[model samples]
Target: MSGLNSQRGVGLVEVLVAVLLLSVAVLGFSALQMRAITATDESLVRTRSLTLVRNLAEVMRAYPEAYVTGSGATFTTVLPTIASAVPTVQAIATSIAIAEADSGDSVTIDGLIISINGANNCLSTGTTTDDDDNEIPNKLCSINQLAARDTLLVKKTALEEDIKLAVVSCPADATQQAIQQQMCIITAWNDTKALIDDTDTKACANSDGVYKIGSHCLISEAY
Candidate 1:
């Protein structure tokens, strides 16, 4: 009887050890699953951002003059506020929203890098004062005031890519040349990225579904 009792106790100890190991394995597997979800979410958003950049490129190619400076010129990006949201602006913005919906991503256009001009140069003086008397970083253009040959060009670049576009001259072709020098449009948007902590990414806050995050602007003659 004594021997049998000892054997039973040993069996119980072995059972408890197995259960503990199994619990640890379960917890580890859960963590791995969470990580996979995060990775997948980030990948989808990145792909969507790429798609947006490409679409903007195609749109501007058809309307180069609308965005770039004439005579092989290019301008820097500026954010413009809405003076009054006109029907034309609405129509254009709507088109982009529709495209995003079709692509299964929810990011929308949030920034416009409008082109600015000054005396005989597309580049602006860093110390120039705006009408408000505040020293501005550079001349940034408005979005709503686009006119003939003026543009709202959309471009995409990687975060690791150049912050400002390089010195690229427009080709001789009239259509290509239109997006040169002082006239240009560069747009950026927000998109959601995966989060391990999920604390402060407003774009992705409401639900697990993707939203907009950072902005990336590119110029004509850029890739």
Candidate 2:
């Protein structure tokens, strides 16, 4: 009877050990699953940001008149800054008037739509000859600035709430005209925390257009 009781006690100990091992394995698997989900979320945000930045670049290209003055002239006015806290379409639209004015286009900020000289429609080329038979120079709402503003406004409204966009001078000390003409579009979002040892507040980026350790942002250069 003594030997039988001893064997029963040993079996119970073995069962407890197996249970503990199973619990540890389950916990480790759960942690791995959580990490995978986080990675997938980060990837989606990154891809969306890339698409938005490229689209902005394309929009700028389409409205070359908004930034270009002559055959080879560079951008005269700087791009507007979009803060992460208040990423509103009207904010972006209202701030673009400087560029519009530089392009010889008078614009009025009315809500999200920037009316060039109070014109409702900007599709018109606005290229018409006056009674004097002289071609109008930089005609109002000439699809130069107004269209750009309106299109950009629409795009801004479509941005995800979690994503933030900002415009900065890339390569802060670039001397070449080509580099100087280009602007950096930064798309930033919250991701995993930095390593415990990392201690950079501007780890993601800075006004000087530099990315440091633990950065969770993407930069795209646009002209």
Candidate 3:
């Protein structure tokens, strides 16, 4: 009887150990599931934020001149002002800030900023004094021109690829014609020097010729 009791006690102890082990495993699995859920939520938020930022960028790019000329109030009115523009602009100013603030995982709210300084160009500078005794410089026109060209080229290339793919997949489709026309226009605008000439002489010489889309000389006296 004593030996039997000792064996029974040992069996109970073993069973209790097994139950404890099983409980730990279940808890671990629950923790993992929670972590996965959290990660997925974070990813979704980040994607939404990125989409919002892109929309904001498009708005600014659409009206590049307006962005340069408009006041803070104008910007707020043009863009969705649910979040202030100043904070959004600050995040874009620095790479680190962009990385840190852009993540949807961050508890802090994210924002978009469009900063356009008419006085300072993205390229090089020329020194001058304004009415307020503030020294100013004209930004390098060449760099801006090149950047614009590059942007257009990238867009054109992507559009051409899509058109080619569509045409291949549907040979007789009328959509191909529109894409083809667009491609031709892009090519003409990019390749024609008369269209993008910034110098006064070129502008004067090409006054009667076909100019590029948004050519400063053709569109406005200030550009």
By lDDT, the best candidate is 2
* lDDT for each candidate structure: 0.34, 0.50, 0.30
RMSD each, Å: 16.4, 10.0, 20.9
lDDT of 3 by residue, 179-212 (tens): 1111111112121221223454333123333353
- Candidate order by lDDT, decreasing, is 2, 1, 3
Kindly list the per-residue Cα lDDT of model 1 for residues 1-223, writing each as its tens digit.
9978766645777889999999999999999999999778656655555554455444434433333111212232222222222222212322322222122211112233233131322244567778999886664323323421122222113222211221222233223222222222232224332221135553222223222345222223332
* Inter-residue clash pairs, candidate 2: none
Candidate 3 ranges with C-alpha deviation above 4 Å: 1-10, 68-223
Candidate 2 residue lDDT tens string, 16-39: 999999999999999999999999
C-alpha lDDT of residue 203 in model 3: 34
* Candidate 1 displacement at residue 46 in angstroms: 1.1
Per-candidate TM equals 0.36, 0.59, 0.30
Clashes of each: 18, 0, 2
- Ranked by lDDT, the better of candidates 1 and 3 is 1
Candidate 3 CA-lDDT value: 0.30
Q: Global lDDT for candidate 2?
A: 0.50
lDDT winner between 2 and 3, please give it: 2
